[model samples]
Target: MDRQPRQSPDFLEALSARSQDIFRRLVERYLETGDPVGSRALSKMLDMQLSPASVRNVMADLEELGLIAAPHTSAGRAPTQEGLRFFVDAMLEVGTMDETERDQIARTVSGGARGGRVEDLLNEASALLSGLSHGAGMVIAAKSDMMLKHVEFVRLDPERAMAILVGQDGQVENRIIDLPPGLTASALTQASNFLARHIVGKTLKEARQSIRRQSERQRAELDEIAQRLVESGLASMIEAETSTPTLIVRGRANLIDDAMASDDLARVRQLFDEIETQKGLLELLDDAETAQGVRIFIGSENKLFSLSGSSVVLSPYKDANDKVIGILGVIGPTRLNYARIVPVVDYTAHVVSRLISKKGEL
Candidate 1:
């Protein structure tokens, strides 16, 4: 059964020190073994003079407060989603990555140090995170604010033409647009020249605004067939580039481990469905872009993973100007090793941001 809704922070603070200690031990034990923790098990781990019966009484209180639950009639108690959230926020101590982990991350990100594309760097980082965390790794590629270096139009058919945009960063993008009827090849060449003159050294958004203003004031001068082609071509290319952020995911196979497949196949299937329909994931990443540092979403805390009992740890990576550009994260079961994974994610974000800042130099 799903856990109860989250209680207020006041509820956590109201617990006695002894009760809090017991709760922390219980949650930690469950996270380690993926099973419920009995009072006998918790008593042995505690330092106080609490017997098994005393521990049982505390566990009972924790249960009534909706912090933990017994999965079966005779089984030990496990922390609910609310309990896990409390443990993560109040009791968890985040640790730094070891030398080996640092070296591995660095190697993965800089493998193409001889000058790789930004897309390649992000893909490598995602794959590395997936391998290290044993969870699905996700990355949103940074949006281009690249200035146009050149623009060309090539007619393919009677009604279609290809718009080739070369950016100042050496990145090339292409889009196909519908040609205005009764337009000649000479008109296409004029349209390409007009766009190149106006948009070179300007970002796509800047070019769009400039075109809009020119269209409004110089309507008579731009009444030719080439002007219509320029307007339609630029509009289509800008919309295609800025419509939605690109999402890259790796290590989805890790989500369906033998234990998950056998014990909770339905939840696994649901998780797969959630990944397939990535609107929820994109929205979650967008929310992370607004926040600083690592953002953790445990189970029902975010509605996207409410039924799947999943967790996501996301961090926003920035550019040279310290603007948040994209997000990267790991997704897995709620019992992921937050202490270890949090530092890995935080470090990876730092590395990615530095790489982005150096994109022009590369």
Candidate 2:
């Protein structure tokens, strides 16, 4: 799906104070109860001395402007997607997490899972977000090239060997390569030592460039066997690193409840299909990386969630150099509690970035 730019909030200037208050309250009530809000119900909540009849007239004006509509043949109203977007952009007051919530996020993302691998930490984060928000949690892992710490080649058979790479972040990866004819144990040692000496602190991309330059110059004083092993080994490792990006999703069960499964099976099925494909979801997150803070995609605002009538709250996390590398977020019904979930998503992104910044130390 094509990405859409965020709508401007200029239209909010047209709404009067009373109209804004009524719209905000109606959206809040619908979000809390998932029910259409009636004029009488709003009259009771507002301190003004307006009667239900007076409120009905205002509701008619709102409906005329396409901000709200009567879902049935009743006086009750529900916010349209446009209305929800307006409320979120103009009137939503983001709340801070309490002590309990702060502790929960810290423990899940960092403290309790101390010294865990980056992948495991991200998995924990997804599960924690799902549990807290009662939604499906997702994380797009950073696929950026890592600083090399160590490299080794172990022989498997006469024609195969395993290239083991250890990054400064304690990330270990292995790639099996088809050996060139008549490669010796001494040649493998020479290749490993050559990589350690030349590229220990450089990123994979930089290391690859350096190796290519050395091979072209033929001035590194290496034997034919050793040079070939270095060429093949580093080429294989670079190919593996540049493969498709990684996506981690947890607590999909949270997306289905007994009530929702029985009442709206079609929507539930569509949600599952979207999650299974994940291409569209990844595209949406890729767009989020351009923005500075948390981004909210409500209902049809994002085509991926259009059919499912769902919403997403996403934020991009950066590395120590402040480069955005990945995204983390949650997905749920459009009526999700934005006041609470927004802070959770924002804070979680902060925690993930902090952990990534300390990767070299670990």
Scored by lDDT, the top model is 1
Q: Write the per-residue lDDT of candidate 1 for residues 245-353, one digit (tens) a residue.
A: 6778889888888336438767767877766676565576567666768878898777767778788887888888888778888888888888778888888888888
Minimal lDDT window, size 10, model 1 = 1-10
lDDT of 1 at 301: 72
Candidate 1: where are CA atoms >4 Å away? 1-8, 72-74, 112-114, 150-164, 174-200, 209-223, 258-262, 280-282, 360-362
Worst 10 residues of 2 by lDDT: 1-10
TM-score, prediction 1? 0.83
Stretches of model 2 off by over 4 angstroms after superposition: 1-5, 8-13, 72-75, 148-170, 174-202, 215-240, 258-262, 280-286
Pairs that collide, model 1: none
> How much lDDT does candidate 2 score?
0.78
